[model samples]
Target: MTEGIRSGTAVGSFWAEEERCGGRAVALPSWLLTTSNEEVAATVARLYGGQSRSRDRQQDLFELTLDNDAIAVNVDGPEAVVNRLVLQQVEEHAPIHVCDGFNFLQPMDNAGDPCGCPESVFDRKAAARSGRGPKPDARLAFRLAAAPDLVIFHLTSSTWEFSDSLSAAVAGMERGDNGAQMTISLQRKAVTTRSGMAVSYVRPILSVIQQEFAAPGQLRLAA
Candidate 1:
């Protein structure tokens, strides 16, 4: 799944259906996914685990801390199956330039792909030179990684829509007669300085999958 994500195949997906209040449903948060255990553990260990770190786990809630930055996972609400995960910087860091831009996409060349090919092109320099690109604004970076039912994120300056997709999928399940679940993956390169102190989360390489319904009551999942 991670490999597929890296090659730009798997993406956030959501399915909607209508179901009764009771059914077989599963909510697997990223932390609960075993495939990413090594990666997540290594990240924490390298970044803030050990002497400088404090960790705690209580039932469905888990927490890890390093200096002023912290990451937490807890059950999401009246819905015990769902989870809410968050990362926060206790003390704001120096402002950094963050830019969000769109580009014209190009068709993939399978022949050049395995070897080398420019899948999409964005003339950032040209835009900047022509004053078409917006001025860099001070902001933070947030990068996310995912595998099927799990998602991990590093606080920095990127946008994520995993929750939205999950909600849509759950809504679909609620509307369907049979139970449903989905798994998707995401991968993207993260940017960091030599010291690794200054970091930036690049935007995801692939587009997210989405589903929408005009009628609200058509499908509603458990809270």
Candidate 2:
């Protein structure tokens, strides 16, 4: 059976409302703003302990997935402030399993018997790359789930460490390097479209950022 909200694996979309909490432009001590992308990535990985899988220089995007698939973090940087720190939850039998060029299926699996469809399972990477995959799953979006250590470690601890890193980064910036602006946005994007998110789940995460940086008046929370 597939994991995460799966009962018997009939291949249904994991539906969740995508919610957006407003974001604010915050100021960092110019010192922290000067660190290179490499330094920022290192600091995030050390604190999160996730394996770094990919980095795109053009996009200034860095991706890391935790050992347990509990979460994946995307750190976009080299801009004024780190553009955004996005956290996406990992689901079982996701796009990684789909063969290249095959249309992406909703769940990409079988209920009782295998779908016998190439798109349902892994094929050559090139094949999967040939064409656009299936449409994004409408029910899917990035959000926090309350698993054993997920909330305490991934949500609380990870955010805390990231904040510390940013603070340290600012301290290292040269005196008077004040041009970039950075913000952390916790959001939910549907596989193909926008989705709705719950306010309850969003509030605490916002609170954490507020307490960590805004308390000293260094940053502000827009939502």
Report the lDDT tens digits of candidate 1 across residue range 124-179: 43443343332221111112222212432321111233433333444543443333
User: Each model's TM-score?
Assistant: 0.22, 0.21
- Alpha-carbon deviation at 177 in model 2, angstroms: 26
Top model number, TM-score = 1
lDDT of 2 by residue, 31-127 (tens): 1111124554454455435455444343554444432222322111111122111222233323433211223222445223332334432352223
Worst lDDT window (10 residues) for model 2?
Answer: 214-223
Worst 10-residue lDDT window, candidate 1: 1-10
* lDDT (Cα atoms) of all candidates against the true structure: 0.26, 0.25
Root-mean-square deviation of every model: 18.3, 20.7
- Candidate 1: where are CA atoms >4 Å away? 1-160, 184-223
Poorly placed runs, candidate 2 (over 4 Å): 1-36, 55-60, 67-214, 220-223
